[model samples]
Target: MRMLLQIAFIVAAGYGALVAAAYFAQAKLVYFPAVGREQVATPAQMGLPHEELTLRTKDGVRLHAWYVSVPQPRGVVLFLHGNAGNISHRLDSLAMFARLGYATLIVDYRGYGRSGGRPSEEGTYLDALAAWRHLTAERGIAPEDVVLFGESLGAAVAAWLAAQVQPRALVILSGFVSVPELGQEVYPFLPVKWLARFRYATADFLKDVSCPVLVAHSRDDEVVPFRHGERLYAVAPGPKSFLELQGGHNEAFFFVRPEWERSLAEFLDSTRPVR
Candidate 1:
């Protein structure tokens, strides 16, 4: 009996230490920005034409973005990428959008790519606003002709902004309901609800978004569970869609090649003005 009691105490103490460590290092775990390898690749390498853009946030942060234009654009796609890699890694996605006849603008959030400053929740929100300003104020694209596309963490930023401003369409790829909910799936033993700093309530925002929305996720996704996408789709009002794809989290686009293009093309078609 004495030996059993000692084991229980040790296990409890070890669990407590792990929880404390998670709280302290939460932000580091959330934002994975590749600092040094910023400008490694360009859209031109993929035989795509793109213009480099410089965005200055209202908070005075300098951000780097790429404006990939199509020959005859049906609408504009303002892309928000995931957390792990910089914009350099997203050249394929950008080229794909450009080839599909939508003007694509992808950016490096603050410290991610060649952009300035450190990465934070509020900082990314400000960076997204800068991207929006570049679209409307600089590029002169009408709000009704702009579509917001986000992947993972970027989805949160896009959903938060879409609540405030209306867009032609919104797309969220493999996003979660909230940070706390995801944390629960990942670290249920820890106090993630209290410790989490980034709670991306995408389902909450979908209630207010007045445009067509698309949520895509894969059952084989190793990172975020597919239920998140389903939950968001359920909450979204009319004209919302949920795309089921194959492959892991990162490989969804590659695995569901034709299906991916078909789904997005349908959405873009809806946005295009009728002749």
Candidate 2:
């Protein structure tokens, strides 16, 4: 009996140590900034008209962005990308929207691409505000004409920002309910609910959003579970739509192009302001 008690004590101590370590290293696990490389290709290289941008965040962090314009654009899309990679990596994806007659502004959060400063949850929220200001305050675009499109980690950021502003539509792809909920799935044995540092409460934020919302997710997603999207849709208030996508989480974009394109155009058109 004594030997069994000693073994149990050892197991408990080891578990405690792991939890403590995870608490400190959580941010590192969350933010994976991509390695920088020479810009060998661009949207223009792919036959799209694009302009490079230098946007400053609320806290003075400079961000690198690209504004891909389409002739007689229906509206503007403020794209918040996934955790990894810079805006250049997503140029191809953004170009698709440009071809569909919507101008796209994809920005690399600080510490990614040529943006200066490290990333944190609060910092990213500030980055979203910066993007909105660049559009409304600088470019003279009305807040009602802008669409917020958040991908993966960016979905949470976009939802948080949309709640605070009156964007025409809020769209999230491969998103989750909250960071702590995801942590619970990843580290079930640990006290993840109480331990996670970043609380990206998308569901909560959506509750307060005044604009239309569109959630796109894949059932075959290997990263974020499909149920997370469903739960989010359920909690989201007025004028919410879901794009039931197929294929893998990352690859679903290619498979769902028809629905993806049709849904967004419809959403934007339905919410288009009278000139």
lDDT of each: 0.84, 0.86
Q: Which residue pairs in candidate 1 collide?
A: none
* Candidate number of the best lDDT: 2
Model 1: residues >4 Å from true position, as ranges? Answer: 1-11, 252-256
lDDT of 1 by residue, 147-258 (tens): 9999988888888878878788899888889888898889877889988877778788778888888888889888889899899899888688878877788773441287
Which portions of model 2 miss their true places by more than 4 Å? 35-40, 252-256
Model 2 RMSD vs true structure: 1.7
- The RMSD of every model to the true structure, in order and in angstroms, is 2.0, 1.7
Highest TM-score among the candidates is held by which one? Answer: 2
Span of ten consecutive residues with least summed lDDT in model 1: 250-259
